[model samples]
Target: MTSPSHHAPGAEHLLTRVGEVLKPALTHYLDLHAHPEVSGAEARTADRFGRRLAAAGCELTHEVGGHGVVGVLRNGDGPRVWLRAELDALPMRERTGLPYASRDDAMHACGHDLHLAAAAGAADLLARLSDRWRGTLLVVGQPAEETLTGAGAMLRDGLYERFGRPDVVLAQHAAPMPSGTVAHAADRVPMAAAGAVLDVVLHGRGGHVATPHLAVDPVVTAAAVVTRLQNVVARETAPADQVTLTVGTVRAGTAANVIPDHAVLGIAVRAAGEASLDRALAAVRRIVRAESAAAGAPREPEVTVASRSAALLCDPHTTGSVRRAHTGLLGPARVLSWPGSMATEDFPLFGDAGAAIHGERGIPLVYWMLGVADPDAWHRTTSDGITSDGAASGAPDAAPPPAPNHSPHFAPHIGSALRPAIAALTVAALDRFAVT
Candidate 1:
C-alpha cells in the first residue's frame, strides 16, 4: 500500500476537532456500555443517540422502525451521505470486569457502543465545521442488527422516502485487531455469507419413567436430528463450498426421570450464497421430519425461519474512495486490506438487494472493519505469550489470541481507539461532501 503525499482536505482540522469532542464521546461510550439493551428493545439506547445528534444540530426523528433513530443535518445543496451505527447489544453477561461494565444480562461485546460514540463525534465535528463543506449528513442509529432484521424494517418504514435517498451509506464493525487500525475488503464483498435463523419443534407422547416402552422421547429425536445435521455440511455440501450449521439451543423436559412431550431447537445456517443456504435449510427440514418419524413422533415436526440476511457486498467505487480517504487521514500503515469473511449482515438491504422494499437501486454502500483491541494487550498475548489477565504463559508461542467480538471478555481500549474512530468516519464523510 502506498502512502498519500498529503492528508485529505481539512484533515488536520478534523483531527483537532476529534480531540475536542473526545470527552463527551467517551462519556457516551461508557454510559452505553453500562446499559445495553438486546435486539428490538433499544429504547434507552435510541434516546441517548438521538439526544446527542440533536445536540449536534441535527433534525432528529425517533422510531423510524422499532426504536430506530435518524438525525439529519443539512447545510446547502450536495450529496446526502448517511452514517450508520447499531443500537442493540447482545444478550450475554459481561465478564470484562471493567469499571463501568453492565450489571444486567445484556452486554455491548461487539463494540456497537464504540461505533455510536464515533458517530456522535463525527456529527459534532461536521456541525462545528459547517463552513468547510456543503451536504446533508444523515446519522442513523439502527436497532435489531443482531437479529438481522433492522435494516429491512427501517426501509419498509420508508427510510429513503421519508428522509431522502442517500448518495452513499457508510458503516463499520469492530474487530479484534490492534486499535487505531482500519480494514477494508479487498474483494468488494466485506461479508460473503447469507444466513438464516430457524426454530424447530418436535412433538411426541409423554409418559412416566416406568412406562418407557409406551412413551416417545422427543429429546432423543432432537439429539438424532442434531447429529444428522452435521452431515449437511460434511457430506452434503461441496468440499469447495463454505457452509456452517449450528444448533445453538435445545430445550426439553425438566426432570431427568420424565419423558419429554416435545423438544424445541434454535438453529442457524450460513453459506456463501442464497442457493447454498436454501439447500442447507432444506436438508435441515428433511432431517428433522425424518428423525421425528423414525422416532415415532406424534405429529409432524415444525420449522420456521426466524430471521435472515443476505451477503454484504460493498460498492467498489465508493469503497475505493473511502479507503483512499482513510489512507490519507491515517496513513497506509493503519489502513489495512481485509479478506472477506463468512459473516452476514442486513446492511445489503440499503443497496440493490432491497430494491423491492425501498423502491430504490444503485445506492452505493461502504463498510469497513475498525480495530478496537489494545495494541499492548494484543501484542502481549499474541507475541509475548502473555494472557489477557497479565499472566505469563509457560509457552510463549502457545499464548491465547485476543478476545473476539461476542466474547464476554471483549473490551475496547477507548483511550487510543476513540480519537481514531471519530476521525476515520469524519474524514470519510468529508470526502463525499462538496468542498467550499
Candidate 2:
C-alpha cells in the first residue's frame, strides 16, 4: 500500500520540481554526517550551512551567537515563517561503521547533521517555489544544543531583534521511530520537560581511614544522600506531578587508604511543570546539604545550577495546521501521534511565550520528531516491547536493537528520510502563508 501524498493546492507540481535537486541535499546530509563538530565549536558546520543558505539566495548573517547563522529571504508581505536546525555534534565517537561515518572523535549522534541538511533542503525547496507564496523565510543554524544553550544564546544575541519575530516557528528532531515516518506532539502541555544541570560538591574533613570517626566522611554522606534521593519522586512528589531525577556521576577519593575531603555529584533534574522542577531542585539541595551537616561536615555543600532548558510547548494553532499540512504531504499512516517525552531541549527558549523561566517571551512554536530507525530494527524493538531507547539499557550486546539518538551506533537512513523531511518542513512553513 502506498502512503497518501498531500500538498498545497498549487504546490504539488512545484514540490515535484524541487525533488529534482533533492539529490544534492541528500549528498549534503551525508557529507555533514561524515564531518561532525561539537557544540560551541561548529565553525566548519556553520560555513557549510552558510554556503548552502547563500546558494539558496538568502540575505545571510553569520555568528549571531557562537557559530550561529541566520538567513532571511524576503518575498512580498505575508506571514513570516521561522525554521531552525541544530549544528553541533556530540563529543562521543561514532561506531556506525557506515561508508560516510565520521573519522573525527566527535559524532553527529543526535542527528543535528540531518536537521541541518533537512533545513537546507527545505530552504532550497521554498526558494524554488517562491512564486507560490508571499512572505519572508527565516532559517536559523543554531549551535551548542547539547549543552542546552544554543537557542538561548541565539535569542540573547538579538536573533528576534535583528531578524524578525516569527509568526510561527517550525523545527524537527530525529527520533528512533521507523524511517519514512514522523511523530508529532502538539498540545497545551509541553511535549518535553524543563530543568537544569546540577553540579554539587559535598565538603568533609579528610582524615586517616583507620580513624574514620575522626574524619567527617563525605563519601558516606554522599552515599546516604543518593539512597535517600531514591525516594524523592517515590515519596515526596505527588502522583499528579511529573518529575525525574538522574544522578549521572559521582566522584570521590583517589586513594583507597585515605578518605577524600569532598565528594562531587553531577545531577540532571527535569519536570513538565516549572513548580515541579523548582521543587525537585530544592529537594536535591536540601538532601545533600542535610546529609553533609548530619555527618558533621566542616562546610555546607555547594550546589550550582549550570544550565536550564525551558519546557517545550507546541502552539496549538501552529501544531494543528502543521499536522494537517504534513498529513497533506505524507499520508496519515506516515504521521503518528508522538508520546510526550521527559527529555529537555533548549528549543524552548525560542518559544518561551508562556514565561517558562523568569520572564521570557517568544514566538509561537511547533517541533516534531523525524523517524530515523531502520524498519526491521524498529519492528524488533516494538515487538519486544522495548519502551526504552536502544542505548538506554546500557546493553549493546544484549541484542541488535535500533540505534537511538546520541548512541555511538546511531545512524539515520538519510537517503530515505530526506525527501519526506524536506517535504514536511516545506509544507509546514508554506502552510503559514498558504491561502485557502
Top candidate by lDDT: 1
Candidate 1 local lDDT, residue 344: 74
TM-score of 1: 0.94
In Å, residue 170's CA in model 2 sits off its true spot by: 0.7
> Candidate 2, TM-score vs. the true structure?
0.88
Candidate 1 accuracy as lDDT? 0.87
**Tens digit of per-residue lDDT, candidate 2, span 267-358:** 99988888889999889988988888789999989998989877888888668877887776667777787767888888877776334332
Regions of model 1 farther than 4 Å from truth: 1-7, 384-398
User: Which digits, one per residue and each the tens of the lDDT, describe model 1 over residues 23-110?
Assistant: 9899999999999999999999999999899989999999988899999999988889899999999999999999999999999998
Q: What's the distance in Å from true for residue 346, model 2? A: 1.6
Report the number of the highest-TM-score candidate. Answer: 1
TM-score of each: 0.94, 0.88
